[model samples]
Target: MKTEFTDIAVIGGGPAGLAAALEAKRAGVKRVVVLERDVELGGILRQCIHDGFGIHRFKKRMSGNEYAQAFIDETEKSDIKAYADTTALELTADRKIYACNSRDGMLEIRAGAVIMTTGCRERTASQALIYGERPAGALTAGAVQRYINIDGYLPGKRAVVLGSGDIGLIMARRMTLEGIEVEGVYEVMSSPGGLTRNIVQCLDDYGIPLHLSATVTKIEGRDRVRAVTVAKTDGSRRPIAGTERVVECDLLVLAVGLIPENELLIKAGAEIDPRTKGAVLNDRFETSLSGIFAAGNAAAVFDLVDYVSVSGEIAARGAVEFLRENTSDKNTENASGGADGYVPVIAGENINFVIPQRVRKGAARDLAFFMRVKTSAPRAELRCLCDGAVAEKKVCRYIAPPEMLSMTPCCAAEREIKIDAVNE
Candidate 1:
């Protein structure tokens, strides 16, 4: 029943929470507390020891644990408070957190600003609607990773992966290295669902087969995963009846996708964008609830961890500024991300969705556009039209519904108009 107060309270201690706490402390916020549910600060990166990360920001390759450790060391020198084994159970619109820690039990905390970096959760078998009998052999790719690498147990001897995303691809190769046989990965789309590098290194290099435009139409197995029914599909994603084939396997891993963890944010009266499944925020990263900021996977899924760290820093700065200005008087005042003030309208063309639908008019300031193309486009021109002018265009070689599209904005303030485009 104890209570505490701080200038900033950061939820979750992954890269995002770490970066946010460090940045806020550096910004002259004296009281900052970081709450993480795990015994350690690092989140999903702890079990991931692969070396494909940090190629962009570090300019060199580093393991996931290595990147996480670097951030830990950096935070050690700062005044940010780290609370491991602490879970935030509830968040209030007024930046109040109701949390519980193993050592301290239940506690109430109020902060001038709150930053949510709860991160995302891996999709489970239920999310895919795979009609397989409940079996221990079937598990999420992330779960299998923790069991083998962290918990030290083999998931299975022979496996068939249901998705071709990064996790599934990496596990497909990893299982092979662990003396397990990976039959192949089945992707529902024509193009692979993961990074191109993964498709090459994890599957192509290892000679693991990948079947595109295919899916698990029927799942077979009684007690455990003895086999599965894989089938090819047509353009409409309907399984071609005669193309079904049964493959023998002891395990089936689903690595379909990750969704943002925003339950607490939503319960706290935050306005969530149905598009991103995350909160809709202003330029400052502050949600409709003033003084509450969100970043990292909890806000929206990112392509790289480097961007996750950067977004964390920005959210912390936003939280600190919100406290400094004490803008309760101007709470209703809205800020524009750009100068020209742009509207967002989608053309009824081959475009799935777009992020930050409303682009504020002004100079471009490193805005990241997250989207998904309507269909597979090969050697097509992807253009963004703003107010009847060609604002941006890119030579798109391929686009898939499974893969996310990230485009950077580069325009003057006059680019504040509705976005309409078509694939040529």
Candidate 2:
């Protein structure tokens, strides 16, 4: 086994990993390294050829590949070492990584700090619980995307998208452009899962119908998908009786949802939050296991790629600070009278979950809090309470479960914090 060392070791060279590596270098962290499972740096973005990305980050509309390339170019020009086609098989809570590549057989990398940007994986057909024999035509929206965009092969002539996620909406448009008939998009929830822009450009402009509160209950055909039975869902999201309709199509694309790929972190004895399905993090993106950080989709699924990059930068900054401090003391008390120099954050009212579930006491820098609401509201107020006193508040014209909310209120010293989204 080969042994190596780095100041920071970033796992998964996707958008988050690349951005983290670059920011670590910018933060004066020497010997930053990135390990990528794919042969190239770009992750899923490589296959996403559609535009509408980078509108916030670069101030211009760009394709997924173009957005990834901007950071890849910067990474290539720097001294940061990136190992492509390398997979991190094991990660320890103490910042040790066991990885393997074609050139480096069975290697061990000891890093001062570790950043996990492993990204998220799509929910498969079996997980969606559609009663049917496994058919060849049944695949995830990502598979359909790779088949058409990367391999230049249309998977089917007629398709039924089972979810209204951003990927499903985009694929609906892509399949239609490629001469494939997209029958319709069915979402189980009352509201669309994707952004409003996607609903307009992908479905509205393309004349594709979006069936809300509907879901595919069954799949038919042994060899290939011949049709599917879609039914209206009630308030509980269960298929309603007497509302089943058969839609004939060769393909069934499942865009149900995504789960963070944090198996490595979980196995390494890190505390996980059931709400986000990620790690319990602080304002600096530092996990409960000190020196280990998680960002981007691995932390929680953000609505935009710009947010993913920003998360990576935040984790990188946290990693750099950890290295400078040379200690794993998250409990170091500040001069302010705080409980162990940390403030526990709570999600109240309409809020579903909030990142940075805790705040380090007396940190001078402002911290951005990202959260999602449990329900939709026309007029709402995002309220922040410190020890039951109103610390900050912001108003919103509209808020929904699908849209994530971000706030960078004035930083506060350690006090029990609670976030609430109240309907006006």
Candidate 3:
């Protein structure tokens, strides 16, 4: 067993971890270490060859690999140390990281602060309740992507995508480009689950039909996926009795949903938000456990990678602040105020949920509140209330559950903030 110490330890060397490690180093942290399970620094981004990333951060459209490479280059130039092929087995609430790698063997890292950026995983066939025989052709969109793009093997010649998520939509286009036929994209919701731009660029541009309010209820085949029964779903998202149709395809690619990868965070005693399935955080991205922070998809499933990197920076800043404060005064108490001074952020009508569920009055700097809507609205009004008084109000031309909305409102001291969205 090897023991190491650092000012900050970042778990997962994807975009979030890379960004956080770099930010911590830039913040004058004496030692910053990033642990990655993969052999390389880039995570899933390495396999994503499609363009449309870096629009918000770089102000230019780039491929996923390109976006990740840019960050990798920056990290290589920085003082932060990266441990590739290292998997974190456990995380303690007190900032101890137990990790293992072929080269390092079992290792224990003690850090002043820790940041979790484990990202997210796709919902599989079983999780989606798609009654099916365990067949080789049934796979998630992400898995197919890795198989096709990374491994250079086509999963199937013909495919039926079960969800209209961004990954499913992109794979529909990717498979078509790779000379595979994409039958159609079936979505359970009336509205598409992906961004409007993806719906246009990936599906509409590729001439692939999107079956809204529809889902695949059953799969048929023993060796491989021979066919699937897709049915129209009613308001309850239940398959209608008489609206079943069979789609014959070799592949059943599921793009159901994404769940944040937070097993280690949960095991470490961090409270999770039921809505986001991520850690409950404050304005600074600090989790329920002091000195522990979460960012990127590990915090919430962000729509854009730009925001993912931003979240890492936020968590790094919080960790740096925590380390500095604790080192300055060993007996200093947690600056986060009491329950009364912590303002609860409520999700009002039509709002799915908001990040940073609570705000410590007068303890936070200018912060952006990220949230998603419950439904689609052509025109909507977003209101931020502080103690029943309107703190900020903005009119948005369009809002949807797929696209995350971010707003930075001036928060008043010692007041509860409520966020709500409604059709205008």
Candidate 4:
């Protein structure tokens, strides 16, 4: 194995990784390296051709490819070394990365700080529990997107989407534009899973029907998908006994949800957050393992790419600070709850989850928390409580599970803090 050393090593070269690497370089990290598993730097954005991106970051509506390309171009001009088609096989908690690529055989990279931006993966048919024969036409929403946008071929003439998430909604519109007939989009939840604009542009404007409180129960086909049984569900999401109906379609696209690709984090013995299914991060995006940070979908499945990039920069800044301070995981872990230690950030009523599950008491700057609500409320108030006292509060006209809220509240609690969203 070839051994190398760097100031920082970043895994995954998607938007988050790119942003992290760039920020680290700007922060004066001399030897920064980025490892990408794909043949190119742009990650899933390469397959996303739609134009609803970069509105927050760039003040213009840009396509995914365009947004990613802007960062890619900047990285090319920087001194950072990026290895394409390189796969990181193992990541140790002590800051060792075992990776391999075609050009560089088996390689070992020792980094002072490591950032994970491995992103997230879509839930497929088997994971979604749509039973039947595994057919060729059954694929995830991402697969269909690549097949049409990149490979230039339609999977089928007619399709049935099993989820109402953003990807499913976008694919419905994409397929319609590609001359494919979209039967409908089904969701077990009563409310739409995607943003309201997506529903307006992708489904409603395109004459596509969205079936709420319904899901595909079974698939029927021998070699290719021919039909699926969809049924209405009760409040608990259990299918109603008499609400089953068969919908005929050659393709079934499952966009049920996304899971962060954090197997390496788990293997490295880093603390995991059950709510976000990522890492137990502090305000700096630093994981419990110290020197190791997580960003983007690898941290949590963010609704916007702009937030993903912002997370990368935050993690990079944390990594830079860790390098400058020359701290170890032992020192960091032992300091929790001390005068300058971290405090627990809890999720209260009507709140699904919050990023940066904890925060340092003496943090220099305000921390922006990204969170989703448990249910929809027309008039709601988001609050931050420290030691049972309301420290910060924001009133919202409307709040919903599908819409992720970003708040930068004053949180300098000594022991614990709670985030709550309640109907007004």
- On residues 1-424, what C-alpha lDDT tens digit does candidate 2 reach at each position? 9999999999988888999999999998889999999899988889989997888899999999999999999999999899999999999978899999889899899999999999998999878888777788998999999999988999999999989989899999999999999999999989899888899999999899999999999999999999999999999999999999999999999999988889999999888899899898888898888789999999998868888898999999999988877755563432223337578889997899999888887655477788999988899999988778887899999998888887776667556778999999
lDDT of 3 by residue, 1-424 (tens): 9999999999999889999998998889989999999899988898899999999999999999999999999999888889999999999999999999999899999999999999999999989988858878999999999999989999998999999889899999999999889999999988887888889999899899999999999999999999999999999999999999999999999999899999999999999999999999987899989899999999999978998899999899989988888878554434674455567888998989999888877643576688999988999999988788887889999998888887788766467788999797
lDDT of 1 by residue, 272-362 (tens): 8776677875445666677898888887776578878877887898788788668456632234433234444353366666554454455
TM-score of each: 0.86, 0.94, 0.96, 0.94
Q: Which stretches of candidate 1 lie over 4 Å from their true place?
A: 327-424
In the order shown, the candidates' Cα RMSDs to the true structure are: 3.8, 2.5, 1.8, 2.5
Per-residue lDDT of 1-424 in model 4, one digit per residue for the tens? 8999999999999999999999999998899999999999988899989998898999999999999999999999999899999999999989999999988899999999999999999998888877888878899999999999999999998999989989999999999999999999999989888888999999999999999999999988999988999999999998999989999999999999999999999999989998899999988898889789999999999978999999999899988988877755555432344325877889887989999898887533567788999989899999988768887899999998877787887656777888999899
Candidate with more favorable, higher TM-score: 1 or 4: 4
Local error of candidate 1 at residue 211 (angstroms): 1.3
Model 4, which residues run further than 4 Å from truth? Answer: 327-340, 388-391
TM-score comparison, 1 vs 2, better candidate: 2
- Descending-lDDT candidate ranking: 4, 3, 2, 1
Q: Of 2 and 4, which scores higher on lDDT?
A: 4
RMSD of 1: 3.8
